[model samples]
Target: MKIAVLDPDRTQADLITQVLTQAGHVVQTFGSGKDLLGQLRKDACDMLVMDWHVHDVAPVDILRRAKEKLPEGTPMMFITNSSGEDDIVAGKDAGADDYLIKPLRRGELLVRTQAMLRRAYPSQNGAEQLTFGQYTFETRPGRLLMSGVPIEVTHKEFYLALLFFRNIGRPLSRAYIHESVWIRETVVPSRTMDTHVSRVRNKLQLRPENGFRLVPVYSYGYRLEKLGG
Candidate 1:
């Protein structure tokens, strides 16, 4: 999982980063709420952890804005020194999935974080295989098979295909797709996305016969639709 942590205290943020990293999660720490918000605009993460006293912007304000910008069901948590009932209520009202008091215990933090992740992504906890139509994706081995036969695909192609399959029948915007897949700060050119889409379409044989159609949504992005559904 990719996680973002925002805390003005470098020591505390580093501690959280170390703990999460040791748990096999990719983490990025920010010392300012503004910087974290800036990054969130161009990238997406599996979870966000924010200190209630972050610099530049109020944590509640940050949480509100984050909830508006991030995809639905993206888990968020608050780590703060405030343990007052009012503060906890405010954090929850502002859309935090969990609240942790400052001077966090490593064991408690890990347990709560994992619990929130599981609640938000129940399907991801134990599933290593994803099936769509005749294609089966083995996530552990990073392989794709069609009707039990392996299909040769580049790394990028496989990820692109997986993304499309996961969001089947949903129109994914170009910006969202780029942020989720490439995960870069720089803007990717439209032609780059187009070329990859073309490759994935041809490579996967996504056509009427395959019972899937990958269609371009005019000026928006792409959609993978199951034929005769």
Candidate 2:
């Protein structure tokens, strides 16, 4: 995905750029809204990550102008330090699809980015609802529901869960998952996958009642097991 990040804070912009690039997305950073507008006038991006604060012109103005100039469907997210009600409302009014209160969590960012991408680009995955254990995953809609309620899962987390479910009762090596999900050249520490898996397990509501367990197959990999399996 091609992304544009607009933020006067060089450090934050750099951090975002690094994370997105590391995830194998092309990222272009601009220090101000004016620069972003100029670039947009020339070319539109797949997504935009805009900081709430920028010198002179407001981020909202840029969003409004971008909406007018480019396709109305351009995806965008707002990154902000403020969680104030007004700020959130303003961001929404400016056509921001999602809002993240800083400091940003990499997992959260990945999830949200996947969500935006999933929304912006429709999936060809045929399963509308996938059942594993007591939970259900809606692939095309990109939602995870447990006991009839929606549970939040980031894009990568959702993908990880889906992959595991598809291979239920089987041990899937970490190397296989890394290759399937992440950039081949990206050397993510072993612990990173573990952390993401842990998060999925924690949030999945998979239990005795739920009829599922994400079990670690020591020395080999992990498996998604159903009750009595």
Candidate 3:
């Protein structure tokens, strides 16, 4: 998953990124609310980690505004020095999914982040199988069964298909998809994403007729959307 960390303090933001990245997530850091909001306008991240009080901005305001820009159901957490009950309540009321006091234990941070993400996006949390309308994904073995008829797919194709299904209606950046499927490939091949996505779309019949469509993002990656029934 891709996570966005918003903290004006470079040290704290870096620390959060390191903790989450070590756990297999791709992290992007933002030094100010403006930067984070600008990025969110173009791409969607799986989760957000923020500091309740930034420089001089009012508490809960950034969270409230950021929440309005994020795709629905995206999880967000606050990591700050304060632990006041009222502060926590305010954070939650403003759309924060969870709160963590400063001097965070790495283990606890990881656990809370994981739990929040799992709850927010339950389809990909170690489940062996996931079904979307007529398409069924047996993730353990990377198999796809369309209306009970099996379909053959390569490993990358299976992963690509699964990623799209799990993130239905959300636009995923190209780098995020590449990281999720090609975990070790640092330099993305020029045509690799296009090729694999094309194959997945064709093989799975991901068109409006099939109740889904896999389309390219304007300048980012791709989005899998479920069509009207």
lDDT of each: 0.83, 0.79, 0.82
Model 1 clash number: 0
**TM-scores for all candidates?**
0.55, 0.56, 0.54
Error of 2 at 9 (Å): 1.3
TM-score of 2: 0.56
The ten-residue window of minimal lDDT in model 2 covers 177-186
lDDT of 3 by residue, 9-116 (tens): 888787788768756699999887778877988988989998876765565887887788888998999876655778788889998888998765554677689789
Candidate 2 Cα misplacement greater than 4 A, ranges: 123-229
**Top model by TM-score, which number?**
2
Ranking by TM-score: 2, 1, 3
The full ranking of all candidates by lDDT, starting with the best, is 1, 3, 2
Kindly provide the TM-score of model 1 when superposed on the true structure, using C-alpha atoms.
Answer: 0.55
**How does candidate 1 score on lDDT?**
0.83
lDDT string for model 1 (1-229, tens) is 9999998888888878876875568999998888988998999889998888876998889999999888999999998774567778889999998888867655456657878887998888764687887999876467999988998987667877887887789998887577556643357788988999999899889999999999999889999999987
lDDT computed for candidate 2: 0.79
Summarize candidate 2's per-residue lDDT along 1-229 as a digit string, tens digits: 7998888888878878866774558999999788899999899888888888777787778878877876767788988775566777888998889988787655467668767876886652244687765678887667998778898989778878877887778898877677545633358788889998999899996666677888898987799888875
> How much RMSD separates candidate 1 from the native structure?
14.3
Clashes of each: 0, 2, 0
Error of 1 at 111 (Å): 0.7
